[model samples]
Target: MIILAATPIGNLGDASRRLVEALANAEVIAAEDTRTASSLLRALGVDNRPRMIALHEHNEVERAAELVELAREQDVLVLTDAGMPAISDPGFPLVQAAAAADVTVTAIPGPSAVLTALALSGLPTDRFTFEGFVPRKSRVPALSKLAREERTMVFFESPHRIAESLDDMATAFGGDRPAAVCRELTKLHEEIRRGPLAELAEWATGGVRGEIVVVVGGAAAASLDLPTAIAQVLALVEGGARLKEAATEVADATGLGRRELYEGALKERGR
Candidate 1:
């Protein structure tokens, strides 16, 4: 069986009983950083050290097949430095391989920076998307991809790049679009800063530390005339947002209702 476990994002107490048992019993552990995994195990008071292997970005592709092979014979546990494996981490390829090999796969779900940020964001969470992290290079293209994400969107970023990412979001969406920057979630000194993208960008410029999670509100409803709303939606869409997202941005920007703007955009798209 293949077990994908969630490690604590910051607080070690967040580790679950299942995760602890998995660590104790697993024959092999694939970790992004072996030293971090060892430290976590020690902190949890688990004396046994399982055979640990490195499986970060550089070697994930080659390592995945080997890990999958191990899962076919014995229990293999995959973990990252923090949070769940494969969530913007290094476990997806192994999971994919295990699935192809018909291996039984499961998760010992626990702490998540994504969910933690969303819960603290004070934004709409009923419908949300986790984008992991935006691409470092070609940020414009990356922001464009998320332009149409209608659900509240979550992104992981480093402290240094938070300001730049926020600025790009402001440009991709609108300066006034709502967002929240959650730092050091589930840890002491945790902070949640919420407001428009422009304001957040400015606030981040002063300097930031610790882990960063960004939660952005979806585009606003379009209350303007059909043609005007359509134009606004089209502009955002052309600039790299999804159509549904563009409509939301238009609605928010124009103080129009969501349903109306959605319908208008659909009509314009001949949907």
Candidate 2:
């Protein structure tokens, strides 16, 4: 059997009793960082010494088979530095390997950064998606694809990139899109800043620190009428956005035709 465990994201006190007990009795543990695992055991006051193996993004693929084989004999507890193993962390491949080998896999669910951020975001939580982290190089293109997504979105990001990321998001989804920036959640200096994407992006320019989670509200459900949409295109053009680019933006958000928006705006401009 393979046991996937959830570690506290920030507050150590959030560690569940089941997690503590599992660590106390675990014979073998595959941890994202063995040193961090050791530190966790020490912090939790677990006296039992479990054999630990390193399993992270760099080596999880090759290590999965070995860990899966060990699970056939006894339960192998899986852990990451914080949050659940296999989330944005390094446990999915191992779990997949175990599944392919027909080994039983179970989880000791507890704290999750994704869930914590979403619940605290004040956005519609009934439907949502966890997008792990935004790409470093292809950020805009990647986020632009999600511009029309109706489900609330959650993404993890580093402090250094938060400002640029939020700015790019504003450009993709429009500055008025609702969003929340969660920083250092469950920690001493935790903050939840909720507002329009433009406002948040501007505030982030001052600099941000610590673990970050961004929650963006889904696109509005109804598409605007063509005339209204075209007017929006013209308005954007008036604000210095290229006519074609402005039309494309409105078309994407309002489910209209890019050509129609561009032509309509052009005719209106001529009139």
Candidate 3:
């Protein structure tokens, strides 16, 4: 069996009993950072240390196969530096390999930065999407992809790039889109800044510290004027986005007025 364990994001007390037992009993532990895993176990007073092997982005492919081989003989536990494995971490490939090999896979669910941030974001949690981390350089495309995301969006961003990211989000989603910048979540200086994307961009200019989770409210579900809707749809289309996607982006940016954009696009496309 292959067990995917969730580790604490910040507070050590967040670690669950199942996670503790998994850490203690597993024959081998594939950890993103062996040192951190050791520290966590030590903090929890867990003495039985499993053989720890580093399995991060560079080594995950090779290590995953080895772990799967071990799983054929004994239980193997996969963990990340923080949060659940495979979530913007180096566990998806291993999970995929295990699934293909018919290995019994399970998760000892515990602390999750994504869920914690989303819950505290004061945004619509009923329908939300986790985008992990955005590309460091290919930001335009990244923002374009998110422009059409109807559900509330959650993102993990570094302190340094927070301002730039918010600016790009403002450009893609509209400057007035409501959002929250959650900083140092679950820690002593935890703070949540809620406002429009433009305001958040301005706020982040002075610098932000600690781990950052950004949650943006979905576009309002209302209609827009025909000219405004057409202009937005044309901009997206000119940026290489498809008509359907462009329509969605324009609608989300301008509120429920997507039908007008769709119709305008049809006429423009001569369809």
Candidate 4:
């Protein structure tokens, strides 16, 4: 059997009893960081020392087959530095490999930075999307695609990029879009800053420290009428957007027909 254990994101006290027992009995452990896994065992006072092997992003695919084979003989445990495996961390490859080999896989669920940040974000949680980390470059275009996204959006970001990312988000989602920036979650310096995207962008400009999770409210429920949307498209075209690009963007934002918006813009231009 293959067991996937959830590790605490920050506070060690969040470790589950099942997680402790699993660690105590694991025959072979695949960890994102072997040193961190050792520290975790010591922190939890777990006595059993399983043979630990690294299973991080750089080597997971190559090691999955080996780990799965070992699981066939005895229980194999998988863990990340924090939170559940296969989230924004490593473990998916191993899970896929184990599944392909028909090996039994189970999970010991516990602490989660994703859930923790979302819960504290103050945004509507019923409908939300976890986007993981924002793309380093091309982030603007990436966010543009989500300009019409109705569900609240969650993202992980580095401290250095927080300000610029929030600025880009404001540009894509609108400055008035409500958002929250969660920093160092579950840690001693945990901070949750909530406001409009513009405000958050300005705040992050001073720089931030520690791990970060950004949660932004979705686009407004109300959509613009077709005529209003067409006018907006034309304005964008006048501002240098290609006719198709402007029409598509406005149509997406207003839930209008792209073809109709394009036709309307062209007709207005002809007039």
lDDT score of residue 160 within candidate 3: 94
Task: Locate the minimum summed-lDDT window of 10 residues in model 4.
Answer: 224-233
Give the range where candidate 2 is weakest over 10 consecutive residues by summed lDDT: 224-233
Q: After superposition, how far is residue 123 of candidate 1 from its true place, in Å?
A: 0.4
Q: For residues 71-187, write the lDDT of model 3, one tens digit per residue.
A: 999888888988999999999999999999998889999888889888998889999998889668756555655665679999999999999999877766777889999987778
Winner by lDDT:
2
TM-score quality measure for candidate 3 = 0.84
**TM-score for each prediction?**
0.82, 0.87, 0.84, 0.86
Winner on lDDT (1 vs 4): 4
Q: Which residue ranges in model 1 land beyond 4 Å of their true spot?
A: 223-271
Candidate 4: which pairs clash? Answer: none
Candidate lDDT scores, in order, read 0.83, 0.89, 0.83, 0.87
Clash count, one per candidate? 13, 0, 2, 0
Q: Name the TM-score of candidate 2.
A: 0.87
**Weakest ten-residue segment in model 1 by summed lDDT:** 220-229
lDDT of 3: 0.83
Write the number of the candidate with greater TM-score, choosing between 1 and 3.
Answer: 3
